[model samples]
Target: MAIRAAGEHKQRITINIAIDGLRLRDEKTGDCLYHHPVHKISFIAQDMIDSRAFGYIFGSPDTGRRFFGIKTDKAASQVKCREIDM
Candidate 1:
């Protein structure tokens, strides 16, 4: 997944994910933005151990927030700052 701003002056990011690796590239020039290795986990036998774990924990598919981060607590503060700047 990637996101781009509207204008040429703006920057864009392109992210690629794989089983054992992840890479991010710049959309405009096809430059390597970032690269990282990921650990692969297999849950094939996990289903046999606990069938109930395969189902959703919260019952609702959309119950959780779309974005999560250490900076999530500062979201309101950041919005307030932007509002003041406006």
Candidate 2:
């Protein structure tokens, strides 16, 4: 855990993500199927003591599959604002 004071935000949290491509394989032939890119995100609290989550995202970026997507007025109103639990 790395801690740096940003000033005026005590319990501020940060989310770090890494996006990489993984090869998919076929079951019968054991051949490469396709390259799938996934996003892995990690959450860290400002205190640097308690960490929150480790999640993976595999979906369309424009539509924002499942847990993540663009937040617009329509989307925001449709979705509730709360802590994400997985």
Q: Candidate 1: where are CA atoms >4 Å away? A: 1-10, 40-86
TM-score of each: 0.33, 0.25
Highest TM-score: give the candidate number.
1
For model 2, the superposed segments whose C-alpha errors exceed 4 Å read 1-20, 38-55, 63-86
What is the C-alpha lDDT profile of model 1 across 24-43, one tens digit per residue? Answer: 57878889865544332111
| Tens-digit per-residue lDDT, 1-86, candidate 2 | 22344445223222221245444344456566444343322221121222222223455657554432222223232122221222
- Candidate whose lDDT is highest: 1
> What is model 1's C-alpha RMSD?
19.2
* Residue-level error in angstroms, candidate 1, position 86: 41
Backbone atom clashes (below 3 Å) for every candidate: 0, 0
